[model samples]
Target chain A: MVSRAGVDEIRAILDGVRDPEMPALSITDLGIVREIRQEDDTVVVALTPTYSGCPATRVIQDDVVRALHENGIESVRVEVRLAPAWSTDWLTPRGRERLREFGIAPPSGIVDGPVVVSVACPRCGSFATRERSHFGSTPCKALYRCDVCLEPFEYVKPH
Target chain B: MRDSARIEYVLRFGDGALVLAQRLCAWVAHAPVMEEDVAVANVSLDLFGQARMWLSYAGELEGAGRDEDRLAFHRDAREFHNVLLVERPNGDFADTTVRGYFYDLWASLALSELAGSHDERIAAIAQKSRKENAYHLRRSQDWIVRLGDGTQESHARVTRAVDELWRYTGELFIGDDVDAVAVGDGFGFAPEALREPWLERVRATFAQATLDVPPDTWMQRGGKQGVHTEDLGYLLAEMQVLPRSMPEAVW
Candidate 1:
């Protein structure tokens, strides 16, 4: 079992971590964390991203190090996991609700399953949203515009 | 055409990337030079990743219960839609240079066109793949000229490879059902517009490589319809057998 202190440290350190573009939220809130393990004095944090070509990876890594260092943990290693590819469905319940409130639609379908359903537009309660582009502001999100509101939004393809 | 065509189109591009990646991977431990070897491996990884995306998307488009792995492994050689140029066995270093030269010229423009695809998925893949293609093109261009102008032996080898692969270049721009689906859905545009830049780049590269450019003669086309050389059978056998054998296998 992980020590209470270790868990709390992780939570504390991660609290300061903000996404490069969406600064108001932390990665923990984004649901990018897959697992965490500690061996000796080394902390290995395994992470998955919504997409492989995430441009903000460097910033995320830097923030991870900064957060840990400030808490007296200087030699932490942040390892990235490529398998079990992240899906937007990983977004936390609160994150999804927050996204809806922020005027951005939450993910439409469950990525792990095969059932396809129409995506709903957050701006307007319409099933008429369409994807405008696969690559968005960051590599992970796709560009989508709601036909109802006609407002283009950045969708977080949750990791 | 049915949505199945869309799946095939995605597969064709994916198989092209996967096959090329396999060939490039061959140079991982045996590149002509150390740095070049590492670069080749890195490029191979990128190609492999792109292949995964294309195959995955193709599977989704097909809605036939096949994911990336099944699509990759279960398909027979005749079922694959990759062009002959990519499947051409990697020869000497000069041969490799020529192969890359031909591909980069077409890929540079194909990706640029794809970046604007009406289909968001294709466009997204295009956006990322285009950046990689840009670098790959530059790298190939640098070497094309260097090898083309290098010693007599290097020049001759590169020239031979270029000539042999020229016939296959026509297959790149031919559109089919998948193109239709993407276009019909208002997600992409005609790939024919890519021919000009592709041709210009090819002409420039050939000049720099010290290789005489092949005349804009009548070109043969067929791969877009899935007709491939006999060699593809052996290749598919190796690339797909394990996955086919262990159908449910997953890590």
Candidate 2:
């Protein structure tokens, strides 16, 4: 039997596991880590994909395992859960700040219905931005150009 | 037989996604602009992911030990159950956009309802896909409006595409015994139900773009039942080459 403390420890280790694509953000901060549990002395971590066909998913899964092993935790299992789909609203406040520091605008705000958001420029904090493209370097982001600063940036889409 | 029907039903979703995903990848380096290239590729990636999920579930239901890759690469053209619309060739930019517009519009409607399906797995996949589908619809819808409302050349191209592709769309709304079985089991709904909403939205968008809506024509059928056009064979040949050549190869 595993104790509750063990589960929290696993969660803490996982919180340090960063996304391979956006290394500035942790998987937990990105809100893909759905659940952490301890069963029979094995730590199980559940993850949800931000987008269906993200190439980094497999890499992230491997990274999680490696990080735990390096931290002296053995018998780790990662499960992908799709029932409660991942959403940008789950990005932690600190995660949002990290995105800004990384030069990508966080999602505009908590949204409903449609995902049309007037993104503020991450670098200059200007609200005068126009969408350059509906897609960007990654599936989770869209290309936006700040009219004020004349700077092109990526915005995390509100999915 | 019920299990067989379920497998068949799920394969439709899988094969449609897989075939269209392949079709869209043709535009990766060839799209009109860099942003469009990335957008098309990103959309294809989403479809590929959805294809993997649907095919994985279909394999589990079949219980014949065939996984997603085996099912995708091993299947012959005659075995694919994707709609004729998806297998249709990606012609010009306008043709590809129009084709995607139709499918995305239908997917937007179908997936929203499927998200509430009685089957938990179906609901989960539908819910996840629905989110992506929304963005896809918005992109295609915006392009349709832009092209149809833009220069005379652009308007003519998209109009011709709509005319060419309209016949293939009727097959999406036709339901059969497999759909009946899925509906009876409470995990599926008739596609015919979405047709009106699809048309309403299409007409509204076409109006905004100043494009004339074409009159309904005799619709194409048979893709859902594994009877595909000549296009699917060539598509399968190109997609299945590596796997067909080396049965045991793995990445």
Candidate 1 residue pairs in clash (backbone atoms < 3 Å): A88-A158, B117-B187, B118-B187, B118-B188, B119-B187
Highest TM-score: give the candidate number.
2
Error of 1 at A20 (Å): 20
Report every candidate's CA lDDT. 0.72, 0.92
Backbone N/Cα/C clashes per model: 5, 0
Clashing pairs in 2: none
Docking class of 2: high
The runs of at least 3 residues in candidate 1 whose Cα sits more than 4 Å from the true structure, single-residue gaps closed, are A1-159
lDDT tens readout by residue for model 2, B89-206: 9999999999999999999888888898888898999999999988899999999999999999999999999999999999989999999998899989898898899999999999
lDDT tens digits by residue: candidate 1, B1-251: 65676666677778888888878888877987655775576567667777877888888888778887777788777788787788878888878877877887777777677777766788777666765665567677888898889999888888888778788777776676677776777665556667777888778767766679887666666555677777677777877777778877886
Candidate whose DockQ is highest: 2
lDDT score, candidate 1, position B217: 62
Report the lDDT of model 2 for residue B241.
98
